[model samples]
Target: MTERSRHLSVHVDRPVAEVYAFASDPANLPLWAPGLGGPLVHEDGAWSVLTPHGRARLEMTPLNEHGVLDHVVTTPSGERVHVPLRVVADGAGSEVVFTLRRAPGTSEEEFEQDAERVNADLALLKQVVEAGAAGGAGGPAGA
Candidate 1:
């Protein structure tokens, strides 16, 4: 059974490279995505975050010029959920797309709630990237 998926995107008034640079950094996730809990912790060369579901490990795709920001979140229960994201050029700005998938047994209400949370996170990402561009701050820790 294929899982239901939704492609949610936001347009940011920043260059694709700039947007990708910031969003691809795991260190910057907490700045825009609050659903991931607090700051990231790096241990034994792996990144982890304290989500409401407890400590979850994150496996991210390698940085590339194509603006792929795909990642996998390994839940405490050992469920690995793939998150597909991208930053594509939109004229002088960029479009950030996040594909949210409905896991098996997830209700319609739960899926909708997840989409809402992703939308909020994307909005915050736009705000942060635009603000940083204006203020000349590279990103989290000058990323």
Candidate 2:
């Protein structure tokens, strides 16, 4: 089958729970997520996100068929993005595994660009969370 995937891993100098608490909450994307803006959320699982290039409305459907938490979001460009978030322990730090898969229609170049942008956001997430963990500047992304 044709597929696209992006794997991003980061070591946050914080407890796994702390890192997971911030990263897992999509609503806080605006505060820490780079190249994206606004996490306007709704009661029915719909969210509005503003990208550097444009805006997107994401509709999330949570599924519990397996032991993992799985969600699918519809991108602003009409592409469905599948995401799997996993948290692992690594001694004094924490490891985050992000698996992204999408179908084709857009060029690989475009995908690569998007990946870079998204990866930058992930890196910022680590920074923001770790920065907060040390009692330096970690506040609710929404707060």
Candidate 3:
């Protein structure tokens, strides 16, 4: 069986570095990506959150100048899901792209629901970033 994927993107009225700085911080996940669930807790040199599926561990890529926000979520059942995210320069603004992939045995309806959730998350991200930009803050918490 072939896996399917959807690339959802949103435009933020901020520089790539600013957007990356905000979105790259796990502490800001609750502000935009609420689908990930409650606040992130940093423990034992790792970040974990209380997701709908229970506690899940998150491993994000190190901060870099390349604008890569890739992360892996280890589900309660020990399923490691890779989420590919990026912030690319779009003129003076930036475009955030998130790739949502269909897992094996997932139904079409489930995939569509996932896509919708991602779209909503991206929209929220745009609003938060733009609002912060308007406030003269380079990024979230001035990061």
Q: Each candidate: how many clashes?
A: 0, 1, 0
Each candidate: what lDDT?
Answer: 0.85, 0.60, 0.85
Evaluate residue 51 in candidate 1 and report its C-alpha lDDT on the 0 to 100 scale: 81
| Stronger candidate by TM-score (1 vs 2) | 1
How displaced is residue 28 in candidate 1, in Å? 0.6
lDDT of 2 by residue, 26-140 (tens): 6666656646556455555567676654666654434222213235556667766666666566676677666655456768887777677667876887888877832322322
The TM-score between candidate 3 and the true structure equals 0.90
Q: What's every prediction's RMSD, in angstroms?
A: 4.0, 6.0, 3.5
Off by over 4 Å in 2: 36-39, 43-45, 50-70, 76-79, 133-143
TM-score of each: 0.90, 0.68, 0.90
For model 1, the stretches where C-alpha displacement exceeds 4 angstroms are 133-143
Model 3 regions lying over 4 Å from their true place: 133-143
- For residues 46-132, write the lDDT of model 1, one tens digit per residue: 999988778999999987778889999999999888899998888788899999998889999999999999999999999999998
Decide which is better by lDDT, 1 or 2.
Answer: 1
TM-score of 2: 0.68
> Relative to the unseen true structure, what is the Cα RMSD of model 2?
6.0
